[model samples]
Every structure is written in C-alpha cells, then in structure tokens.
Target: MSLRLRLNLLVAALNLGFLGALTWLLIDNHRNSIQEEIEAAHRVTVQMLGSAAQTSPVFGPAPVVMVNFLQSLGRVRANDIRLYTADGVLRYSSPPSAYKAGRTAPDWFGGLMRSTVEATVIGLPGARIEIVPDASRAVLDAWDSMTAIFLLGLGFVAMLHVALLLFLRRLLRPTEADARRLVATTQELAENREVMRLIEAGIEQERKRLARELHDELGQSVTAIRLIATSISRSSEAPGVTQGAGKVNEIAAGLYDSVHRIVRELRPAVLEQPDLAAALADLGREWRIRNPDIDLSMVLEGDLGDLGEELTLAVFRCVQEALTNVLKHAGATRVRLAVAQREDRLEAIIEDDGQGEPNALAGSGHGLVGMRERVATLGGSLETGMRPEGGFRVSIVLPLAGDSQ
Candidate 1:
C-alpha cells in the first residue's frame, strides 16, 4: 500500500478503537446506574406495600381494603401492584405507567440494562398483595441517553477523522516548486553521469593513442639503437670500444623493456580481448615481481573473460588503484585480490594484511575517489574500509545485465 493510504488506515483504526473504548465504558456505567436505580425503587416500593398489608386487617377484610387502597394509590413509579383472592381470582390490577406509556426499549437493550430485583408478596387472612418490579421505563431512558451520547461521539469522530485526513493530505502533498526542483536535480545528475562516461571514454582513447605511438615510434628507435650497439661490439677490435658498445647495448635493452612496460600499462592486451581474469593475472604477476616484499595472491572465479570491455576495465582499474593505495599507505606484507562473476553481477575484493588505517579512503588523495567514479560510471559501487583482521579492504560490485557500455 501507498504510505498515504497506510497512514490513513492507521488513523482510522485509532479512531475506531477510541470509539469502541468509550462505548464500552459508557455501557458499563449506564448498566450499573440502571441496576442501582431499579433496585432502590423496588426496595422502597416493597417496604411501603408490606407495611400497608399489615394494617389493612384493622380497616376491613384484607382483600377489599387493599383493593380500595390500590385503586386510590394508582400506578407506582417502578412497581406493579396486584391484589388476588385466596381462590386465585384477580381482584385488582395496577394501571400501566403514563410516563413513556406506549414506548418500550428493544428486547436486547432491555436485557442488557434490566435489573434483577425480585417480586415481593405479602400474605393476609383472605388475600395476597403482589408487588412485582417494573424497570421498562428506566431501561428505555438509559437506552435513549446512551444512543444520544453514542451518536454525538460518532459525529465528532467522523468530523475529526475528516479533518485529520485533510491535514495529512495537505502536509504530504508536494508543491509545484518542489516538483520542478526535483526534476531539475534528476536531470542534472543524469547529465553529470553522462559527462563522466564521456570523459572516461576520452581518457581511454588518449591512452590507446599514446601506447600506439610509443610502440610504433619509440619502440623501433630503441630497437635500432640496440642493433647498432650489437654491431659495434662485434666489429670493434679495441677492448675499450667493445666495452663501451656492450654498455650501450645493455642500457638500450633496459630502456626498451621500460618503454614496453609503460605501453602495456597504458593499453593492456587484456583490454583488447576483454578478459578480466587474464588481465588481473598479468597485473598480479607484475606487481609481485616489482613489490617482492608484499606477497600478492589473486583468485578468479566464473567466466571473467566474457565481462564486456567497460566492466572489465572498470574492475581492473579499481583493483589496480586499491593495490597502489595499499603499497603507499598500508605497510602490508601480503595482499589478497578476489574477482568473481556470479550470475548477473561481478564482485571484486582486495585486502591487505598490514596495519590498516580506518580513514584511508577519507584521506587527501584522489585515488579512491577516482576509483569510485570509474565504478559508478559502469553502474557499479565501490566500498573501502579497514578490515576487522588488521588490514584495509576495497570491494567493488558491478551489474552485468543491461549495464551501459
């Protein structure tokens, strides 16, 4: 459900609960009041009639005097009086109450509010006086009062609910200005991402160009120099000349090796083939060779070779930058790199086994930031932190399905 609907439902539920509780409390109070009122009225009526029954024999025959007395007495408030002869003949009956005379409470409501006062009977020489409790009027009054209160409460709750819903709707509704600003911000973010993608693509193109120039121009020149030095060393008869030629040839070979290494770094062969596993393997081998003090371990899983060029390059560069940071900041002895392609996503983790700095990523260096940008461009995320086991860790995840090139 929508948040607005859920909130509205919550408010409605609270209102209903409050109404239910109030109703229950009122019912309990009214029930008690009716019971007490009816009981007190019945008690008084019984006592009054019982006293009159004892004195009736002094006036005349018990039945005749009581009948005359009841006819004069008229309808009692909450009792029905009747005089019956000893032969079971009904001599006199109390008149129906004129107060709410024709009306009665419903059976269910009357049952709920009715009191349990018993009928009173007085015996005399020839007749009996029966005073039965009558609570219909009292019960009807309670029902009327409760119904009025309930209706009032219901109307108030409905108005409150409507008012609250209106207030919430206004509070949650977004303004036109806010909507415009949100749209503008979203467009700006999209443009920024596009700009970053273009920048990265341009950088890669330049690197390729530089690698080609070094390989084609500088590489040939260095080869020519080495060939000339080798020729001079073989042809010269002077011992000094041979020694100088040999030295020149040795330096040229070293220079050539350095140039090739730089070209490889600029435009790795793995990028052309887009094999991340092979690229990482070559990188680890070279890293171990150069930084022999720090042992580098690499683990590749799944089909790393088929990750598109953009994703492969992004992962490789992130891992490369992370290792460089480890070497520069962490005084580590061992580094572990793991890359796995699991279904629709690629994950890479790089960790070092040296004293870790918790705030390494927050330092005044752009390495981590650059790596993050690179990964983000490929619809990926980068996380860097100090490992719990006394090292720094860098983790990256990239989505393979439907990712932008």
Candidate 2:
C-alpha cells in the first residue's frame, strides 16, 4: 500500500477505536447512574407510603383511606405505585408518565440500563401499597444524549481525518514545476554524456588515421633518407664526403626514431592487440627513459588484457593525463599507478609524492574534464584530491558491462 493510504487507514482505525471506547464508557456510566437514580426514587416512595399506611387505620377504614390517599397522589418520578385490598381487588394504580409520554427506549437499551431494585409492599389493616422502580424514561433520555454526543464526536473525527490527509498530501507531493525541472536536468545530463562519448570516439578515430598516415608517409621517407645516406657514405672515397654522409645518416636515423615514437603514442599497439598490461608496460618503460629523474611504479592485478578496448583506452588515457599533470605541475619525484579489475568493476589509482595543489582537480583543465567524461561515459566515477599524507591522488572506478546500467 502507498504510505498515504496506510496513514489514512491507521488514522481511521484510531478514530473508530476512540469512539468505541468512549461509547463503552458512556454506556457504563449511564447504566450506573440510572440504577442509582431509580433506586433512590423507589426508596423514598416506599418509605412515604409505609408511613401513610401506618396512619390510615386511625383516620378511617384502611383500604378506603389509602385509596383516597393514592387518588390524590399523582405518578412519582421513576417509580410506579399500586393499591390492593385484602380480597385481591385492584383499587388504584399509578398513571403512565406524561413526560415524554409517547416515547420509550428500545427493549435492548432498557434491559441494559434496568435497575436491580425490587418492588416494595407496605401492609395496612385491609390493604397493601406496592411501589416498583422504573427507569425507562431516564434510559431514553440517556440514549438521546449519548447519540447526540457520539454523532458530534464522529463528525469531528471525520473532519480531522480529512484535514490531516489534505495536510499530508500538500506536504509530501512535489510541485509540478520542480518535477519538470528535474526531468529537464536529467535529460540534459544524459545528452551531454552521450555527446562526450561520441566526441571521444571521433577523436580516437582521428588519432588512428594520423598514426597510420605518419607511419606510412613520414616514417618511410625518413627510412629512405637514412638508407640513401648509408649508400652515399659507402660509395664515397674522400674523408670529408664520407664524414658528411655519415652525419646525414645519423640525422635521418634520429628523425625516423622521432616519427615512429609519435606514431606509437598516437595509436598504441594495444589498441589492435587489446592488451592493457603490455601497453602500460611500454608506456612506463618510455616514461622512465624520458624522465630518469622521476621514479614511476606500476601495479596491475586481475586480467586487464581481457578488458574491452573502450574501457582499456579510457583507463590508459586517464592515467596518462594524471601522470602528465604530475610531471608538468606537481613536480613529483615518485609516482605510483595501480589498476585492478575485480569481479564486476575496474579501479585505478594514481598517486604522486609531490607538492600537490589542493585546487588542481577543481580547475577548468581540459585533461581533468576529459578524464571525468571518459569515466562517466563508461558508467564509472573519478575522484581527485590531495592525499592526507601529502601529494596528489587520482582515483577511477569503471563498472563492467554486466554491472553497468
């Protein structure tokens, strides 16, 4: 059930329980009150008749005097009176009450409030007077009063329940404008992520094209220059000519090496072989050679070679960007790069022992932005901050295809 419905049901149940308990209490109190009132009225009537009966013989014939006395008397409240002669004649009886004359409480209600007081009989010389306790009128009054009170209580409870539900709906329900804004923001984010993914794919394709062009064009031209210089140096006899040709060969060789390195950086062998471990190893080896002053440590775990091309490239690029930042800005002497693949995700951390800038990650740097976009496109997350123990840290986590949305 919805929370609102559950709350409404709970409130209704509580209201009903309260009404039930209140009604029960009122019934008990009214029943007891009727019993006490009837009993008291019966007691007074019996005592009055007993005293009058004792004095009846002094005045006249007991039956005749008592009959006259009862005729003068009217119906007593909550009690009935009767006069009977010694020969079993019914001389007089109390008239029905004119107060609320046409009405009586229900039998079940009357039975509930009926008093336990018995009829009292007073004997004279030739007659007897009987007074019986009556509580029907009182019960009827109680029933009417209780019904009014219950109806009032029910109305109040119903109103309170409706008010509470209205309040809850107003408090819990989101505004239409806010809901629309949220939807728009979510769609914008999704569109931006998709665009970033497409752009990254296009950039990689361009890099591959460039790498192939440089390898086939610049690389072959440099090799040809080196081979021609070697042939010229072998064919020349003069020391000066031989030495100049030798210099040309050396320059051509250096140009060839530079072109090959650029091609490799643009499109690594790993892209074709899909071996992340070997790619990282080659990168680390070249970094060590280029920057002998800095110590770089790399740790790989799990089967990184099996990670898909996109994931592998994303991780590699992020690490490369982080290392480049460390080299250019961090002035780091030691860097530790670790990439691990777990059951359903990949985690990479790059930490550098250097003078880390606290605001480095927050800056509008393309490298950091690119890294974040790459990881986000792969259903991953990136974190960058200064380490507590000193230096900067970059952390990345990518969910595997099965683990991703």
TM-scores, in order shown? 0.88, 0.66
Model 2 weakest 10-residue run by lDDT: 396-405
lDDT of 1 by residue, 119-210 (tens): 88989889988988888988888888888999999999999999999999989999999999999997887788889988988999999999
Ten residues in a row with the worst lDDT in model 1? Answer: 396-405
lDDT of model 1 at position 73: 88
Query: lDDT score of model 1?
Result: 0.88
Assess the local accuracy of residue 153 in candidate 2 as a C-alpha lDDT between 0 and 100: 94
**Top candidate (TM-score):** 1
Q: In order, how many clashes per candidate?
A: 0, 0
Which candidate leads in lDDT? Answer: 2
